[model samples]
Target: MAARPIIRFPDPRLRQKAEPVVAFDAELRSLAKDLTEAMLAAPGIGITAPHIGVLRRLVVLRLESDAAAQAYLNPEIVWFSPETIRHVEGSVSMPGVNEEIERAARVRVRYQDLDGVEHEEEAEGLRAVCHQHEIDQLDGIFWIDRLSKLKRDRLIKKFEKLQRLGA
Candidate 1:
């Protein structure tokens, strides 16, 4: 599969909620492949279908130390820990800037594999943060929304400047 171009920030599609992936067919598998390639090409740890305007509840993530990539279809966080942790978060759509965002330190997600098999997994630390971030995106919530209004405004301004400067 080829890498798909990521739709940039301020694109209305990014705010649109993704539809659940119902068919676990070859086409879905191919989408997973495309998302993985696109994310790796962006040098991002995680990406979702909405990033490329597919509007499906799918995500591909590859941590810095991972030996393989992982894709989740129709992913949703089933549980969240009371403990909160702050991690700097950014999106492939909104490149060149990031900000600290607080989220549940641990989470258990219910998702399907490319084959449509349901599975639940527990995650912590960066993995947890990444999962929550991607799930939020799937729900039509951009990472910037997790920030305070002041921070979000400031970052949007900075991001727009970067866009204007072709950075």
Candidate 2:
């Protein structure tokens, strides 16, 4: 599979909610494969179909190089823990900027496998963080949306500067 082009930030499509995956077929599998290639090439642990302008509720993640990459179709977080943890998060769309994001320490997500088989599981630590992050993208919630007003303003300015400087 070829690596899909990752759309950059403020692309408007990233802000649009992704459509649910209705058909679990070879096309979906191919898209997932392309997403994995793009994610790995992006040097990011996680990515979503929206990142590549597919606008489908698909996410591919490889938290550890030693572990197999996971593809989740129509992934949604069903529960979250009261405890919260802060982790640095970024996006392939944004490239170089990342900030500490505070998210639930654990989450229970309901997702579909490649064959459209339903599965629900709880995740903790980094896995939990990654799940929340990607799910947010599916919901049209950008990671930077978690930041404070001042921090977000500063980040956009920096990102704009980078774009201007041809970063």
Question: What is candidate 2's lDDT per residue for 29-124, written digit by digit as tens?
Answer: 889999999999988999999999999999998988437899999999999999999999988999879899999999999999999999997899
Q: Which candidate comes out best when scored by TM-score?
A: 1
lDDT of each: 0.93, 0.93
Candidate 1 residue-wise lDDT, 1-167, digit = tens: 55799999999988989999999899998888889889989989999999999999999889987898999999989999999999999999999999999999999999999888899999999999999999999999999988889999999999999999999
Q: Where is the poorest 10-residue window by lDDT in model 2?
A: 60-69
The estimated TM-scores of all candidates read 0.97, 0.96
Q: Candidate 1 at residue 38, lDDT? A: 92
Angstrom error of the Cα, residue 78, model 2: value is 1.2
Q: Give lDDT for model 1.
A: 0.93
